[model samples]
Target: MVDEFLKWYFSQRPVLASQLGADGHDHTLGDFSAAGLTAREREEECWLDRLSRTETPTLDDAIDRDLVLSHLRGSIAMQSWPEWRRDPSAYLGPVFASMFNPFQQRLKPEPELVAAAISRLAEVPAVLAACRANLDPDLAAPLLVQRGLGQARTGRNFLTRTVPSMVEDPDLRARLAAAAEPAAAAFDDLVTFLEGFTCGGTWRMGEKLYSTLLRERELLGYGAAELHEKGRAAWAELDARMREVALRVNGTQDWRAAMETLMDDHPPTLEDMRAEYEAETLRARDFVRERELVTFPEGEECQVLPSAEYARPILAVAHYLAPPPLSSSRTGVFFVPYTPDGFTPEQVRQRLRTNCRAQMPSIAVHEAYPGHHWHLSYLAAGSRTARKVFRTPYFTEGWALYVEKMLHEQGYFDTPATELAHLDCRIFRAARIVVDTALHCEDMSIEQAEEFMATRASLSPGTAQGEVNRYCAWPTQAPSYLTGAIEIERIKESFTGTPREFHDRIAGSGGLPLGLAEQAALA
Candidate 1:
């Protein structure tokens, strides 16, 4: 029943590194059966049309025709995908082009969705320009240019999607009279995607044609609301646990005071802060490798890079970018963002040193080392179809979150300050539950959400605002972090008699969902 072409498309990898199997293991996502198509004759005979027209789960009403188009675009771009190792330019080109494909443009957005997307799109150039001028890094000029080009294309797509959405929304019709530049730029990403990415199946237009994308390419089964609710429950539990940790760290009767004390630590200079984070991340990598805790594909390496402008806003303060491609490159990047003196050294130092619940080490574990980069490498090396078609954010993110808590309970950090940072990270994520749920489900205004983040999560104004917009663009993603982490913890606890070994068995589960995690836990 799985679309056959989609399976082949995912298997090919990118020009950057399609052939570069992880540490010599040929782990293409196709290796696992993306469409669950195992029959040799069927797999060999299927073309894009037959594959694309395959039935899929019903899309939510809120999703417009354009949005569905975007899914089609993804499917199209994915076909003949270049492995990053084999061709970087091709990889970047196709990825960016996919953004425009009239694929995924929403047909009927609420007025607020239109308004917010517009407002944020306007800020892109300004925010990005500042980052480009100020941030420093070691990546070559070619790479930076590639990133900038990708952003330019992405910016275009942002406009293509948002501008029309604005014109369509009754409320934004009045405001649309003014914002010309952003509106123009919005169409940029689309133009590129349309021109650059092409596949045979794109020749048709119909419900089946569009839905095939949602099914074949992404393998995403749920609707917007389903994902949203999943995030809500996750946020709640994380917040509850974070509060408990704050109380413990403060040794205080009141969690509110403990939170204040935790945030009061002075900030750090960009270099020192970046260095500090990088070191911690390295330690995490060593921990996982040293302990032989999980399967680490050889050959690929993780390196710290300065955060690129395109990813600066929503990406974490420090982020992990996978290597160019396994065949061509061995280095992964951890991008650290730079803000002004507002991010003081003292605060950075305190965060690094503090001992509290909802700590920072958990973050380091998740962001670096044996977390994002680690698992990404794990999946990238395999040539499994199901893995590519059915990858889950909850599965990967949950594992990352779990890594932090698992290390802590396992006593990876000797210093209480280090321990506290780990707890604080959890606390912050817990708070994401409230922030994401309130903003999305409760229809909390940006200002209201910002206030919630600042007051409840103990974030600064800049960070709080960032969280607000991130929730808008990403929707239910934030809550997944906590949900996945907590679920991992619960599963481990259920097997308390063998927590260490049980925890060690995590990677073996191979990024299964919580439903499967439960089975894995019991097993």
Candidate 2:
């Protein structure tokens, strides 16, 4: 039953299959680009109804049952939102991903890869046409539409400026260039159309749907109000800890000032920044292995690379791309955004401040060793197809944040400055919960969200704006990190075993929601 369901799911989302490291589907883009709004909703409803009618297999274990149920519920919850029809950025993601997925992996020869990319590129016109038809002008959120325009511009630049260099064959390059022209024009048309319109749609999911989303997608028992309260408490606790550390470091009670001093300790240039990150990643891996914090998978490695041009606009200072579970490759890519040459000296300083020496280790740990790359490597190696295919931000992001705390407790942050940075990271995540809930569930405006993040989380004005822009474009996702981590910590407190044993149990449970993970862990 699971196998049949997976096969159908993959068929409906061929681009997803390519992203997951599946082969043979390389030549085709998915139905996502072509499906109209009504058709897409209908398909989702049909799947939900069908899954509801299907009986759970009697032989299924706790983890298997949890995985299956979570996937079904999460899919239904996602489909309940009209984000695909309302948010242009929603469509832009899959379009950009379809182009990037094929090139990211080395599953095929260069010629075959170029051919697949060309094939996908040729469908770009039809995809954008479908996108234009599917989006309802009445339901378009102005903020999201503007953001989508930015993304489309990035995608256009990628097609025109970056992609040709990636193709070697003269014939393939020519074909790509020809296909890209129409696609780029379509993107221009989209931007023009979006700019002419005024936004009337609300970005808010509202309290009721927001509650349902938490229950279904994250499997969290808490409501939005409760989660917000928890987030506040966590923020207070971390802030207090940072205050203590601040006193120890600088003989002042002002943690924020201490944080600023630490931020001033960044590497001098972007090249040095990359080199520092690489070194920190290695150091983290060594610490994890030497102390036997968690079992490391053999042959699992991560490479630090500069973020792709199209992705840098929305990406933070650093992010990770885990290897596809079904793919033969075990290597992950940790992408760090480099300083663009166009940036002025002040802008460069601001960027560097975000990647200070005190903060780099925490970011490295969260993105590379004993964090996303490490946790995902285990899932890719040990999990079934269904488990690998279905994931939650809570489990993925939560585990990474949880490990950050775990490492701190294990003395990973040896210096007062690093410890302050670690606490600051947690505080930032906690703030995300407050800001995300307020922005979506309350009547918080984008400007208000930016102010809150800047004042409370101590983010620079530019960084705060970027973060708010992300929250506006993607609702509820930003808060999952802290929420998931809190749940994991609660589950850990209930365990009677050692820390390693607790971690092993969670790791072995695939990417189940915290509620489901707890149930499986206890079972």
Candidate 3:
């Protein structure tokens, strides 16, 4: 039954199949190329109804049953929302991701790969047209539409400028260039259409729908109000700790000023950013190994790279891309965006402050060792196919955030300054919880969200705006970092074991929700 379901699921998401390094679906772009939105929703509903009525297989293991139930509920919950049909920005993810996937994992030969790219590029118009047809003009949010326009422009630039340079074959380059024109035109059409619409739609998910989403998608037993309260408590605790550290470092009560002091000690050049991150990643990995914090997979490697041009608009300063779970390779890519030459000296300095020397170690811990790269490597090695395919964002993101604090508690940072960096990240995530909930479940305006984040999270106005824009486009995802980490710490308190044992158990559980992880741990 599981096998049948997996096969059916992959068929519906061919782009996912490509990303997972699966074969037999390489030639086609799948549903993502031209997602039949209405039909897809109806199909999801039917599948959920069928799965709910079916008996659980007696032979299924405990983890399998947990995965199956979670997967079904999450899928149903996602389909229950009409975000994809309403928001044009939502469509941009799959469109760009499909184009980018072929370059990430090369399961095919050069000729076949180039051919695949060409084929996918040729289909871009049809995909955008379908997206246009699916999006409801009445339900479009202004902020989201504006963001979508920016993303569309980025995509167009990538197709024309970046992609052609990536291909060596002259014929393939010409074909790609030709295909880009129509795709770029389609994007222009989308922009013009969106510009004509008045901006009045709400991005708010509301309290009822938001709470239900948490229950179903995250498997959280708590309601929205409870989570918000927990987030507030976490924020207070972290804030107090940060102030204490700041007082020790600067001999003053001004924690934010101390943080600003650390930000000034950043890399001198944009080129140094990658080098700093790479060194810190190695240091973090070494610390984890010496402490025997968790088991490391053999031959697992991670590369630090500059963020692609198309991705810089939406990505944070640093982000990690794990190898596909089913891929033959276990190498992960950590991308950090370099400050462009077009920026003024002040702009460059401000941009580099995000990766200051004191903060690099904590960022390294969160993105690489004992964090996303390490966590994902374990899942790739030990997770079942079904478990790998279905993930809970709360668990995946939560585990990463939890490890940042875990490593600090183990005396990894060793200095008040470094510790402050870790605390700052915690506070930032906590702020995410408050702001994300407020933005989506309340009547908080975009400008208000930007200001709130800038003041509370110590983010610059530009950074806060970018963060708020992301929250607006992607409802509920921003808060998962804090919410997930809180759940993880709660689960950790219940287990009686060595730190290594606890860490291993959590990593070995794949990417199950905290509730499901607790159930599995106790079982």
Candidate 4:
């Protein structure tokens, strides 16, 4: 039954299937038309009903059934807040990924990859047409529309320039260009369509839906009210720590001033910044190995690269992309954003400061090394398809955040400066919980959220804006960093084992919800 459901599931989301290394769907895009969405929702309901009726005879079978049910429920719930009918930016993911995934993977032959890209590229117009037909400008969020414009523009640039430049074969290049021309035109049409919306609806998820998602979808065991309070408390604790470290770093209790002093000590160029990240990643991996902190999966490699043009708008500073679990390649890419074109000198400096030397170690450890790359490698190496496909932010993001603290405790910081940077990051995570909750459930205005982040989280105005926009788009995810880590820490209190043993047990639990992860880890 699970296998049957997965086959049908992957068929509906070809881009996701491709990303997971599932074959036969690389040349298609997801259906977002109203009828298509209706069909999808109906199919999901069918699966939910069927899965709920099945009897589990073993513990593993029961767990697998629960995972499938959880995924179905989440998918069904998301349809209620339909991005296809609202956010014009929603369609850009599969549209861009359709071409990007095929081109980036090293496993496929060049000819096969180019053929897939061309097939997907030819469908781009149809996908964008779906976006046009499905989207109601009256329901569109103005902020999301604005973001869509930037993304579409960048995506158009990619289709015309970056993608064409990536091709090498003369015949394939000509075919790619032939397909790309229409795809680029589709993007231009998308941009024009998006520009017509001068008014928009609310982006808020509201209290009831937000709370339901926390309890049901995420299985996080807490609602927005309680999570908001937890965030406040976490922020307060981290604030106090930051002040103490600030006094040590620069003889002052004002951490913001101390941060300024440290920001000045950074790499000079983007090349230098990328190099610094590469070096820190290697150093962190060496430290983890020397300490035997956790089990390392053999043959996994992490590479540092610049963020793609279209992706930089959302990625902000950096992000980690895990390799496809079903693929033969064991390579993950850590993308660091280059300074965007047309930025003022001050904006460019702010970008550099965010990726500054003092902050790079924590960022490196969080995005690579024993954080995402290391933790995901274990899950990828596992034999279960359900485990490889069903990931929750609570486990994935939480484990990454937890390891930052773990490494700090294991004497990985090496200097007071790095410690201060780590604490500042902790403050930001705490602040995320607060801001994310407020924006979604507490009726906080986007402007207010941006200000709160800029002042409380000590983020630059530009960075704060981007962060708040993300929070508005992705409800209930920002808090996972801290809240999930707290759950892991709670699980740790009763376990008496080596740090490596405990880490290995939980980190390999298939990205389950915190509650289920505890049960699986302790079992």
Q: Worst ten-residue run, lDDT, model 2?
A: 57-66
Per-candidate TM equals: 0.55, 0.94, 0.94, 0.97
Note the Cα lDDT for every prediction shown: 0.48, 0.78, 0.77, 0.84
Q: Quick one: ranking by lDDT, best first?
A: 4, 2, 3, 1
Q: For residues 1-523, what per-residue lDDT tens digits would candidate 1 score against the true structure? A: 3434443544443211223222211211122122232342233344434534555453221122222333345435433321221112322333322222111222123454344434444544433333333322322123223333444544443444334443554446445434435534533533353344322221112234223432343334543344445555654665566566555566644555665665455234456656766677777778877776676767766666555433543443555655423233445566665542234665444433332223345656776656877766655555433333334455677778778776776678656445545655665676676566555454566788888777765566666776666565444456667667766766666675544456445544445555554654475
Which candidate leads in TM-score? 4
- Candidate 4 lDDT over 224-290, as tens digits, reads 8998999999999998889999988999999988887888887887778888999999999999999
Tens digit of per-residue lDDT, candidate 3, span 1-523: 5667678777877777777766766656555322465576667666666655666644225566557766777666666467666677666776677666576655566678777777776777776776677666667677777777767767767777677767677887787777777877777777676667565667777788788878876788876777777778888998888878898889986788988888899998877988989999999999999999999987788888887776766655678878788877678887876643345787667778877998899889988999999988878887478777777779888988899989988999899899888899889999888888887778577888898888777676777787888887777788888888878888889889988888888777778877778876555
Candidate 4 residues lying further than 4 Å off, grouped into runs, are: none
Q: Give model 1's TM-score versus the native structure.
A: 0.55
Residue lDDT tens for model 2, 1-523:
5677677677777778888877667766666543444565566566666655666644334455557666666666766567767887666777677776566655677678777877887777766776677677777777777777767767677886578667777787777777777778888887777677676876777777777778876778877888778878888888888889999778997988888888888999877888899999999999998888888777898998777777766765688888888977778888886654455788777778888999998999999888899988877887567778888888889989999998998899999989989989999999999888888787577889899888777577778888888887777788899888878988888898877777877876677787778876776
Top lDDT hit: 4
The better candidate by TM-score, 3 or 4, is: 4
Q: What ranking of all candidate models by TM-score puts the best one first?
A: 4, 2, 3, 1
